[model samples]
Target chain A: MASNTQDAAHGAAESAPGMPQLDFSTFGNQIFWLAIALVAIYLILSRVALPRIAAVLAERQGTITNDLAAAEDLKAKAVEAEDAYNKALADARAEAQRIAAETRAEIQVGLDEAIAKADEQIAAKAAESEKAIGEIKAGALESVKVVAADTAEALVTALGGKADAKAVAAAVADRMKG
Target chain B: MEGDIAQLGQFIGAGLAAIGSGAAAIGVGHVAGNFLAGALRNPSAAAGQTATLFIGIAFAEALGIFSFLVALLLMFAV
Candidate 1:
């Protein structure tokens, strides 16, 4: 075994000088080119593209915020308008109620005055009727006295006794008085 | 002269790799910062655009990784 190992070692050393070694010499060049590419890409992004994009985004945000604020303001105004409309409606209702109450009072006063006037007119008509009835009664009484005296004179003539008109009238008045 | 040239080449290669990495990092930071700022502004768009942002970052990172690989190859393989 030892003699075989010695022979193998001698043969390997003879072959070693003739065999080519694996080469890895171009890695530096590859790295240098890659580095140059990386630096160039970085410079383009940082210097050329990012700032414009950022500015556009900022402008968009500003517009959104402004729109939101305007919407909020409009909402507030709408609420205020609603409140004002309600208040105005209430005020108008109150004014209408007030006017209605005043009109009712005026109507009531007019009705009361008209009723009072009618009552006065009725009282006056009743008094005039009473006066006319009194005058009629007086006239009827005078006619009744005249009829009674004529009846007495006719009755005396039928009996063939003369009746003095003035005496008969005085006797009838005295009888009625008694 | 040969020794001086080798030293200069090594120095230049290392410097370029370092500069590449540094520049890549700054670029990645800018991309990430802008992405975050945009996401904050429009959260709804963030999810939809996140994949694209990541892709851009990966591309930029690949450049740096490639530079590192080249440096390693120069030192060890070449």
Candidate 2:
């Protein structure tokens, strides 16, 4: 049985010519090193590097989200501020218009009052001038009557040497009547 | 010994090529998935970035295809 096993092994070795014997010991060593390398790589990635990288990435994502939310809030606030500004501007415009209208009305009233006062003053001055003219005309007419009566009495006195005083007076009255 | 060494070399090369192709495919898939997600989120930006995405995929696929070609050459032509 031992001889048979030896012959079988030799035949198997001879079948693949120029093939070296399998080095199981070397294969084992290669496998052990490969395993060590793989484990080291895994440990470095999982325990040392990957955790730190993950933490950094997570922090970056958190910062990004917070910035986006803050931007949205700022946008809302800007819209609110813009709305308030527009409302205030519109209110100011309305107030200005109202004031303008009131000022215009006041100006119109003042102008009307001034015009009425001027008309009253003109009417009073015209009435006073007419009254003054009437008084001057009456005084001039009375002075002319006195001057004419005195001249007629002097002429009658010069022409009535033989006439009585009562007759002369009666003649003057008759002439004045004629 | 020479024949055994040659066979081992072939096996290692084939394994490396296979692993390289698999990794390239996974990397390409990840890039594609992210591109699609970004495109869906912003369709307007998708049009501008489409050419770049395709270029990146082509480059990765070229590497994977080259590895396959090398494996085929080693297996058949060699």
Candidate 3:
């Protein structure tokens, strides 16, 4: 078995001087080229590509924070607006109530003034009517006294009795008094 | 006859080295597929993970290149 392996190794070594890449003379060149390529790739990625990516990430973060802050500001503004509206509504209600009370007081004063004027007019009319009634009653009583004196004098003369006018008038005045 | 046997041995060794290259291909595929899956799930974080994905690809591809080199060496070198 050992002889067979040796034969195989010898034959393979003799065949075409083996792989050119495996040649010791070219190893240094291959290693140098590989190192150059790796370094170039590393430098390009770390310095250029990686920094740009980092910048984009930072920019996106800034935009998100700004948007959130703006939203918070808008929320605060909305709350303030609601509070202002509520205050205005309350003020309007109070003003309306004040106007209503003022209007009610003015109306009540006008009604009282009107009622007092009407009562004064009615009292003046009643006093004038009572004075007229008293004057009519006095005139009627004087007419009745004169009519009774004339009737008594006429009755005595028709009976052919002597009726003095002065005596008859005095008797009528005394009877009226009784 | 000895020369023929040696050539046959070299060819067989080269073929065996090709298996290593194929395994490296599977490793690269795994790395890339996992990165894509993660990237799709969180697009905002995708950029952050890209460097790691490239590094994984580079390591896997290096293994494949080494395997190819080994295959070449087996076929031609002692």
Q: What lDDT score belongs to each candidate, Candidate 1 first?
A: 0.78, 0.74, 0.84
Please provide, for model 3 over B1-78, each residue's C-alpha lDDT reduced to its tens digit, 9 standing for 90 to 100.
Answer: 244576677778889998998999999999999999988999899999889999999999899989888887776675
Candidate 2, residue B58: Cα displacement in angstroms equals 10
Query: Residue-wise lDDT of candidate 2 within A11-103, one digit each (tens)?
Result: 545654212324344678888999999999999999989999999999999999999999999999999999999999999999999999999
Interface Cα RMSD for all candidates? 14.6, 13.4, 6.2
2 or 3, greater by lDDT: 3
Worst 10 residues of 2 chain B by lDDT: B1-10
lDDT digits (tens) for residues B2-68 of candidate 1: 2335545654686677677777898888889999999999999899998989998998888888787
Clash totals for all candidate models: 3, 0, 0
* Ranking of predictions according to lDDT: 3, 1, 2
Question: Among these predicted structures, which one has the highest lDDT?
Answer: 3
- State candidate 2's DockQ: 0.08
Which docking class does model 2 fall in?
A: incorrect
Rank order (by DockQ, best first): 3, 2, 1
- In candidate 1, which residue pairs clash? A24-B77, A24-B78, A25-B78
Q: Give the CAPRI class of candidate 1.
A: incorrect
Candidate 2 Cα errors over 4 Å, as ranges: A1-28, A123-178, B1-78
